[model samples]
Target: MSGGILSPLDRAIVRATQEGLPLVERPYHAVAEAVGTTPEEVMARMERLLAAGVIRRIGLVPNHYALGYGFNGMTVWDVADEDIAEAGLLVGNLDFVSHCYHRPRHLPHWPYSLFAMIHAKEKAAADALVASIAQLLGPLSRGHLVLFSSRILKKTGLRL
Candidate 1:
């Protein structure tokens, strides 16, 4: 693992996977070719990287909207800094929540510190998920807002 000190080859492997694994019968072989390594070595290195905690997951990222999860809302909250970790863990565990993370507040005008994205087939379902998050946070949340997305302008995850 080298204590997360990635070698040049390790960095190359990470970079190759960033754009996402290639769609092929042997994706690892493709990655190996791109990184100038053998497929077995690539798989072993990836396993080590995973055990080292440098990589959290490697899997498909589906477009839920295409699968009838049309309503997506970003629920933002102004939570006490001390309680955010606990509250965020609870919110992130909800089945409807797709993503959750902490972000810096913009102060006076924009004060949300934690954000959670919920996806559902309808607006009412998304609203119910927001309500569940509100109940979980309870007094820990000073204020919260749910902004339902009207459309998907861009779908790809940012690579740079």
Candidate 2:
């Protein structure tokens, strides 16, 4: 784990990909070229970094708005603690859901514990998607709300 610290070469690799991996047929090769290493080395280091929890994940963060998915909503659900696991799995597996997970409720003001982000083409479609999740959950779902995004937020990964 290197004492949970990033080595110089590892720092360089992270810097090269902090913004995002280069758009290329071989992204690792591009990262290697940028960091003065080889493709295989980059891949190996990345694997080790991931295993050591230095890097949480490496995946695409598509601009949903640009893709015509203008109605982006984060659906929050008030599912009983006992049914959170089942509810999360049911909502998370929906085709339109991009991500879903459980969170601690903040009490009186905020009671939702399950959150799922959904993207759709229109408001009606987004509402329908939420309804579908409610139907799937049935009695397990206490309440829910879809909070639409107001603006785009800059997304980035670890920075060296």
- Give the number of the best model, judged by TM-score: 2
What is candidate 1's local distance difference test score? 0.87
Query: Model 2 over residues 1-160: C-alpha lDDT tens digits?
Result: 3888888899998888878889999999999998999999999999999888888888999999899999999999999999999998898888889999999999999999999999999999999999999999999999998899987899865476
lDDT of each: 0.87, 0.91
**Candidate 2 pairs with clashing backbones:** none
Per model, how many backbone clashes are there? 0, 0
Q: Which stretches of candidate 1 lie over 4 Å from their true place?
A: 1-16, 33-36, 48-57, 153-160
> For every model shown, what is its TM-score relative to the native structure?
0.75, 0.94
Displacement of residue 112 (Cα, Å) in model 2 is 1.0
- The 10-residue segment of model 1 with minimum total lDDT is 151-160
| Top candidate (lDDT) | 2
Q: Candidate 2: where are CA atoms >4 Å away?
A: none
